[model samples]
Structure formats: structure tokens, C-alpha cells
Target: MVQRIDVECKNESYPIFIGELPQKLEFEGSVLVVTNSKVAGIHLRTLLQCIYAKECFVCVLEDGEEYKNIQSVQRILETAFIHKLDRQSTMIAFGGGVVGDIVGFAAGIFMRGISFVQIPTTLLAQVDASIGGKTAINNKFGKNLIGLFHQPKAVYVNPFFLGTLSHREKSSGIAEIIKMAVMFDKDFFEWLSMQNLQGSSLLEAIMRAILIKKEVVVKDELERGVRMALNYGHTFGHVIEKETQYKQYLHGEAVSMGMIMANRLAVQLGYLSVDEEFRIQKILEKNDLPIYYKIPSMESFYQSLFLDKKNENHQIRFILPHNIGRFIPCTHLSKAEIMRTLEEFCDD
Candidate 1:
């Protein structure tokens, strides 16, 4: 049977469907299908055929992280307005993380919070971004800097949709999955290590990641406490995205590199065993993820840490692993300490 998970937040409880996309959604309204050109070209017909609604509008945008800006969000909003979507109209994000975040954010504020559904096609979307209800667009400062905690009414995760994912894209999603297992479920991490990410078993891995995310988000919807664990690799990852200006690396690519940095920091802090750190490197390398980067300097990236929404009183919070599956946050580290940690792992 297809396993289902749900995130119970203060205001709402949303269900995450892991398996095939359902033939119909229980919510009824005019639906706006917001996606990118690449995904729409591949899945439009199937998505349209699956939806039982009488009215549907397909809103397509250019695909990639560079396109995930306020302009895109505005474009999506314009399309919804042009189509005359009212409060009853539901917005459906039918692609990867960027699509989901932009569409969900728009739906959240469109006429003061309308309903939205997530049909996340990428592994990254299905396991992490699409389920969290943290919808947003990037800004001049950093990735995902401006957004809202607007959860989807439902999330339909179809592994079949990932068939089109490039090796790089798959690796990006896998990094988030790795983060999930490493932070919340130790057994799941061991289970993950044993399995091959091919065929039907891929669905199982996705479900496991979704479960980890669902449980954590339910406890801390606004990322106050336990929810910070989700940023395990993201602290450095976001800086990397900003440094490169979101051009050279995929979101997951930057994250995989960020994990390498995190592991190195863990070892320096007496948290990660050397053998464990190296093993993590091996896994990421085996998956073809970049384990190192040639950053010019640590000053700008380190400076960006202060702007993190999770930071308190200018003290940047970090999520560090105690062991393979145990990660903790608010484990405050000093600026000099953080810079030294970055120096050790960050390449010249």
C-alpha cells in the first residue's frame, strides 16, 4: 500500500501522498497549473487528464534556480489574475521546488490566503520542499530569504515524475534526503545506505524522507526549535548559492558541498569522528556530488550567516550532527570558530 504522512501544524493539518498522483483532489475550484516550460512540455497532458476539474489554466515559466525570483512570483500572480482566479480557485504547483515555492507563496497571499495543492515532480520537491509549507522566492540577499509558512492543502508525490530528472538534479534531491535521514531517523539512514536508488525502491526512499520532514515540521512549523534541524546543510548551502549568484550549481549540488563542510566542522568540534566524516564524503562522491568548492574567501559568505532568519541576537545558529542520525541546533559556535571551520573545509 502507498504510505501516507501528514504535517499537523497549529492552523492546519496537510496530508502528503506518497506514491502515484491521485486521480482527483477533494477540493473543488478553478485550478491554475503553475509550472516551468520543461515540466509542462513533459507532463502537461498527463496532468490535465488526471485532473477532474472543468476549468484549468496552465501557467509556465522558464526552469531553473535563476528563475526563482520575485519577478517569477509576480508573473504567476499576473497569470492567476488574468485567468480571474478568485478565493475559491486553487493554485497547483506542478513541478520542482522553485515552482512549488513560488506558486504556494502566491496562493498564500492571493486575496489573503487561498488554498493550494502541490504536485511536486522532482525528488527534491517530493521529499523536502513541497511538504514543508515554507513557500518563497529568492532575493538579492540569499536564497529563500523572502517567503511565508503557507502549507499546501495536500501534496501528491509521484516518483514516476522523476524519470526526467538529470543525474545532477537527482543528486540534489538525494542530498536533502540524506539530510533528513541524518537528522531524524538513524535507522532510515542505515536503510538508505543499503538500498540502490533505482526503480520502485526510489519511492520508498522518498517516503522515508517525507516522513522525517512531516514529523519535524508538525512539531515546529515556524522553524523555532526542532525545525532548525532541517537547515543542517542549508546554512552553508544558502551562502554558496549567493556567492555563485545561483548560477553555477544546482540547489542540491550546493547542499552536497555544504554537507562536506558541515562534516568537517563536526570533526573539528569533536562531534564527528574522522572515519564518519570521510564516509559521508564517499557517499556524496559516489553519487557524483561535488564535495569541494573553490570559493575566493569566507568573509562574504560568513557575513551572510547573520542574516539567517534562524539567527538570534546576531548569534548565528548552526545545525551540527552528534552522530550519524542525531543533529542538534542552538549549539552556538563563535564567529572565529565558524570562520576556522569554514577555512578547513572550504577550498582555496
Candidate 2:
């Protein structure tokens, strides 16, 4: 069964089609499908068969988080230029989050902004990254530090792609699904805690997560207000990704650890109870998500917090869970308080 969710933003509105890949994807103009070597080797042909554009081309880059940089974006642009794609062309992001981000950023700047569609192959991209218009490439300084808000024309989330993901990759996507529940839906959180997340249950979870994000994005497309809450674990998760140079853990794995650290802080701040914190951690652990990371340096980690995009006025902001299913963006905590939390995670 196919489920369609419409996301209406202030600047643009699009539909997210979930279930099976359409038999035919017709485009009026030329099309460029951006993907990675890993994804191309597996699912490229399936996607290629579905396209019926005036001109279709493919550009496959190296697959890995380390390659999510300006160089990759340049490669995508180079392909578009070589193919003579114009303002009327559309780009298709046919892989995972890194692929989607690169393709979206390139599409956003191509001819001063063209159009792109997301065919996110990985579970992580389908539920979280694919829905948001936030596109970016990482730099030496941080993750997603360079890019813009380039909304896709539409998003096609085919569950068939999930079957190809490794167990670890699936867990990575589950982390984001859990994030949505923890921040906005108490019943969903309770429901997730009980289920094993397979078959129909997983599909239901994906639809619910997309709907939750859609409601928030429509209200604050530019992330000027309540939308910031969506970065619940991202503030710390991005730091973990950067520190490890995006090698050690998947995006969702880093987020899993980030949530643990954030929950500890919430418990200390009296916003979440100890039992609630345990429940959150238990759910993550149940999904085989990592809940711990030894801090390399407390001082360095604290300084890195300021580099997160969510920070304002040099004060690091945190999205702390309020008793589960509710969240508040906090910026009033002192450095000493944050340092203490970091100290708790340091390995002896």
C-alpha cells in the first residue's frame, strides 16, 4: 500500500511518496542522477529503468562520510556542466544522506538554483534527511557547514531499498525515528519501546516520523523558531561526527550516543526523571545503538559545541528532552555545568 504525505513549507510544498518506486518517473527536462559507487553498484539500474527524461545522465562518487566535502559537490557540478544541464533540468539524489546532501547543494546552486528529487536509498535518508530542505557539504571546520536550504521537488521513499541496508545501517535510521518520538510523541515512544520494529511496524514508524517532521517544517521552514527543536541530539551528534572525522560511527550511531549525553544533562537539570532517561537509553540499546563514547578532551569538546550551527550569540544551545515527548531549546547553562557533564563521559 502506498502512503502519501504532503509537506507544505512557506517557500515550497512537496509530496513524500512512500512504499514502492513508481514504475515511471517522467521529467519534462534533462535529468542528472547523483549517487555513490556503493549505491550505484546495487540499485542504480533499478532507478535508471524508472526514468523517462529528455536527457538522462549519472554521476557516481566515492561512498563514505569523509567524501562529503566541497570536492564531491564540485564533481556533481562538473557532471552537470559536461552534460550541459540547464535551468530547466532536474537532478535526482539516488542514494543515501550524503548523496542527497551533495546533489541538493549542487542543484541549489546550478544555474542559480534548479530542481532536484530525492530517491533516498538508505533508511536514514528516507525518514529524516530526505524530508528536510537543509542541504550541505562538510568542511575542515564542521559537518554541514557549507550549503543552503534547497528543497527537493518531491521525495520517493521506496521500502524496497531498506532490504539492501546492512543491519548497522538500519539501526542508524532507527535512531532518527526514536529521536522524533522522544521529542514530540509520548505514545509513539511508548509504542516503540514495546515493538521489535519489523515488517508493518517499521512502515508505520516511518510514516509517523515523516508526519511529525512535516508539521514542524511547515510551521518554520527557515528554522527561525520551533523548528530548531528538531536538532534534538544533533548539537552533540555533529561534534561526535567531526571528532571521529566521520569514520567511527554512522550518523545515527553518533546521534544515539549524543542522545545519551543529552539525556544525562536533562536529568541533571531536573527536566527529565532518572527512570525516563533509562527508558530512552534502553530503547537505543535495544536497537543495537551505541550509548557511550569516551570523550577525548573535555575542553576541546566544550569549545566544539560553539561551532554547531544551532548556536546563537556564542552561547551553545541544547535541545533537552522534557519528561519524554516534549523538548525545550536551552541556552542558559553555564560552561561549568556543561563541563561537568562532559567529565562524566570521559574514559578513565
Q: Note the Cα lDDT for every prediction shown.
A: 0.84, 0.92
For all predictions, the C-alpha RMSD in Å is 1.6, 0.8
> Which regions in candidate 2 have their CA more than 4 angstroms from the true location?
none
Model 2's lDDT to the true fold? 0.92
lDDT of 2 by residue, 1-348 (tens): 778888987777899999888889999999999999999999999999999998999999999888899999999999999999999999999988999998999999998999999999988899899987999999888889999998999999999999989999999999999999999999999999999997889988988988998898888888888888888888889999999999999999999999999998998899999999999999999999999989999888898888888888899999999999999889979998998789899975
Residues forming the 10-long window of minimal summed lDDT in candidate 1: 19-28
For each candidate in turn, the TM-score is: 0.96, 0.99
Off by over 4 Å in 1: 25-27, 330-332, 345-348
For model 1, how does the per-residue alpha-carbon lDDT over 60-91 read when each residue is reduced to its tens digit? Answer: 99998898999998898898899888999899
Candidate 1 shows a clash count of 0
Candidate 2 colliding pairs: none
